[model samples]
Target: MSGIYIHVPFCLSKCYYCAFYSMPSLKRKDEYLESLRQEMVARKDYLHGMPVSTVYFGGGTPSLLTPEELKTILNLLHDHFPVEADAELTLEANPDTLSLEYLEALNAMGFNRLSIGIQSFFDDDLRYLGRRHDSRHARQCIDWARSAGFDNLSLDLIYGLPTSTADQWNRNLDLFFATGAPHLSAYALTLEPNSILTKRIAMGKAQPVEETAAVRDYGILCQRAAKEGFVHYEISNFCRPGFRSKHNSSYWFQTPYLGLGPAAHSFDGKERRWNAETLDGIRSEYEALTPENAYNEYVMLRLRTMWGLDLKYIRREMGDAFADHCERQAAPLVAQGRLSRTREFLYLTDPQMLFADGIAAALFY
Candidate 1:
């Protein structure tokens, strides 16, 4: 149930909406790779020899790494950790970088899952987002992945673009489902501070995102995904049965995980830790999870998914007073149809998912 997350911080160019730490040039690739290996060796015992159930290489673009470099890293992990024989190893990829040959090699190297960042299958949206690949390239990449024998594939899509219309979003979803990928991670386009999109909006060069439009699009997505028989397992993720992301689910269930590389966070049941955002400060930042903090996170994380919170478990683990507080807070939401409860669990209604964070915060002790 535990996981490992490796953050690869290199990309060919910056996307307009990206706020993640990444360097544009691979001029320092060797240095970074060496540093990554060193970090892995140093943190080898962090999991206490727990059998890693999942290994996720998320990035700037993990596919940018050569097969040999990837092999070396995986070899190091195998050498140092008790990685499960059938671990769900995933690599986040950009379409432009994936070829049949490269994908075949990746499959041979133990990457069973591919999370391709397509963003949108529209050329206009791709250009607006500053993505390197076009619509055709994305389709070709999926074809190549299937040809290379990858069945557990995930596609990343961004909806709620300022110029996105309902028809356009539907077309995106239609094309996405046609690809037969088992998992989809659709996200709303947010204007994060200091991002290129945010700056453009500030300069009056780009229109600000319409909150109402985004909500409407989210509704469209939910309805469409349900019709397609995809499970809305998490607020932003839809997957076919038995295809939920094991690594991400570990986070929701509060299983211990060790995160490697800059800007990565980790939890070990009681304490939470994170590495610094910059390579120069790759050391750890530690915080002990107090009873209050843990209770807040337990509710927050559980509320983000379809699994919801187990009230009985909370009463047993977090005490009856906390459980009673939750019931009192939830009674109004349930009455208003924003929340729903069964004998054992409570969860947000689909429409209320957009307000999950706020609702969780409001219910916090």
Candidate 2:
């Protein structure tokens, strides 16, 4: 099954660590939405009648869109695409922008999933990250979403902030688990180049992230998630059974998908395309996947998930020689406890998951 992604590039305020394309003002909201609709209509045939399994509204704060604006876009999608009856439609929201009434309206408009950006539940941490929502707002938003009948809720948390301590990080996780959210996406804080946080660190105005502390926090997250019966599905994502983000899984499994709006990316199984990070409309850059590129991506993406790499499928799709080479390369790593293999799949061991990208790179053809 394929998927569709819509990027909303307007935010009330910019986070210090964010690198995604977005503006703090909604000056061009109408024009951007119109262009998004046009882009969808123009790219309707891109998926070639494949039933769209998921529709994800990601962004610079999707909750900022009014109900009418959101509904208009959803209606356009329904009219133009073959969206599945039970498609996993998701919207990324910020706690500060969501209201009980607004969330209920979103539910009525066919959004079955809500991923809220609650980076931290501590006021200090929130301020340090330059997030608009305070701890109380975050908790209230979750309670309101539950009241609004959103069962498939996901919460995003960022750990390893410069001022965060181990106890504080644990408290954050405890609070997160108490919310009863079925899905969680936790990421370690990293300063992106040219971002406010990075600039501050360079100027010695803010402390840089400590690698040891970040690693410890990641370990804590994995252990807590396992104890809580959440599957560490992706390196950075944990979910209750049957609650994985299907749209995100499509990308990892190399399924074809189309992305609309600014700074969105799409993959067509063999080629990859992405729009420029500009509100000037959907100008895109495309690349035809080479054999090496496909092989590297196949290993890289699958290795990052719990599903692991399917050796049999790889052999059939990529060739027996390539599959054999992978197994041969993995033999040593498996012995070193960095990787483990079942009868037909190979995956990174829990302790070595932090090195997944490097491990995948080492096994690249």
Give RMSD to native, each candidate.
1.1, 1.1
Error of 2 at 70 (Å): 0.5
The pairs that clash in candidate 2 are: none
> After superposing candidate 1, which stretches have Cα over 4 Å from the reference?
none
Write candidate 1's Cα lDDT for 1-365 as tens digits.
58999998889999989999888878877887887888888888888888899999998888999999999989988998899999999999999888999999999988999999999999988987889999998999999999898899999999888778999999999999999999999988987888998888888987878888879889999999999999998889999998999999999999899988888898888899998877774688999998888889999999989988899999999998889988889889888888888988999767678778988887788
Per-prediction tally of clashes: 0, 0
- Local distance difference test, candidate 1: 0.90
Model 1 poorest 10 in a row by lDDT: 275-284
| Cα-based lDDT for every prediction | 0.90, 0.91
TM-score of each: 0.98, 0.97
